[model samples]
Target: MHNRLHLTYANQSDQEYLSIYGKAKITENRQKVDDLWSSFLKVWFSGKDDPNLALLCVTIEDAYYWDQKNNKAVTIFKMAKAAITGEKSDTSDKGTLNI
Candidate 1:
């Protein structure tokens, strides 16, 4: 498993939107996103049975297929899976999942 997860916007518009939203909504909780992913990784690597794993996987799958129009979400899910599997993904210079 990787140690970090890097999120990149799918396009300039998406990047700008996230920048604005982050500044406005997450200004006081900048680490909220990172913390959430960190917790997810921890649970994933715990080696113990986690009932939520199935739900989480299903949710990601749903987002990838149902939200196909949202390139950002698709990229995130793809990269996240690659990170967990220690496999090289098709991720380009566009973005990355550090962990």
Candidate 2:
């Protein structure tokens, strides 16, 4: 039963990931988001196992390059995390925010 629940959660996560990826892929600027994501991973989180990083990266791409309204939310979330952890966000580094 425990394994079954874990499997279900994994499946749902994969579906959500695919949904986000599909949204980006179908956009007029499809390759831009993917390229930015690849650079982000290479620079900041290479070989890390954090599953939600893709979602965060996609959110950043949409908010910044696509002029989406979610930038405030992302900024607040990052600020909150930094406040709690007392560490500056690596995402603020030069070229990391480029799309």
Candidate 3:
């Protein structure tokens, strides 16, 4: 299993990245199961009290965020725009947070 993943969150400005890093753990805690119960889970489970409900919990090792980060489609547009405008293709605002 992979021990780490690079999580990316969209932020409008460089100072707004909401990224977080950690060791991922999974659980089926009943309290958590009930709190986040959704109709989607009903497709596979009997109900909130179903014994199969699983929740993802993480032990954060680090976190970071980047601002002005665009999703794939937007990034493509930025590249195209740069091609036409002769301006530097800006993918996003760069920033980092280690926590």
Candidate 4:
């Protein structure tokens, strides 16, 4: 089974909690929440082998960006793994970690 993870971005205002967690939990600026969701989707869905995973970003702005490739499943996977492992994966200078 694929592992799922939830990451939270720090410095989130009280308002940002609802969207990240739920309405009963808290809320945040609409635009900021949307941007955070967008970033998570960009990685979670774009990756191939779409493994079962969850990335809960608190700030979302910390997300790294590489060149706009047609599809960046490989890149996304590397980033996820790095996040989980707390160390950079075997990647070239450009951060392309060959799985």
Q: What TM-score do all the candidates reach, one by one?
A: 0.25, 0.21, 0.50, 0.21
Clashing residue pairs in candidate 4 are: 7-56, 9-58, 15-27, 15-28, 16-27, 16-28, 18-26, 18-27
Q: Candidate 4: global Cα-lDDT? A: 0.41
Q: How many clashing residue pairs are found in candidate 1?
A: 6
**Ranking, lDDT, top scorer first:** 3, 4, 1, 2
- The models' CA-based lDDT, in order, is 0.38, 0.37, 0.72, 0.41
Residue 54 lDDT in model 3?
Answer: 65
Indicate the residue-level lDDT of 20 in model 1: 12
Per-residue alpha-carbon lDDT of candidate 1 for residues 9-46, written as tens digits (9 for 90 to 100): 34464433211111111132334434444554664555
Poorest lDDT segment (10 consecutive residues) of candidate 4:
14-23
Q: What residue runs in model 2 are displaced by over 4 Å at the alpha carbon?
A: 1-70, 90-99
Best by lDDT: 3
Model 3: lDDT to the true structure: 0.72
For candidate 3, which ten residues in a row score worst on lDDT? Answer: 8-17
Write one digit per residue (lDDT tens) for candidate 4, span 39-84.
5566547532234433333332123213323235665787789999
Tens digit of lDDT per residue, candidate 2, span 1-99? Answer: 121111111233222211111122223343554555555475666533434344322222311111222355675787789999998854332112233
Q: After superposition, how far is residue 13 of candidate 1 from its true place, in Å?
A: 2.1
Clashes of each: 6, 0, 1, 8
For model 2 the local lDDT of residue 74 reads 74
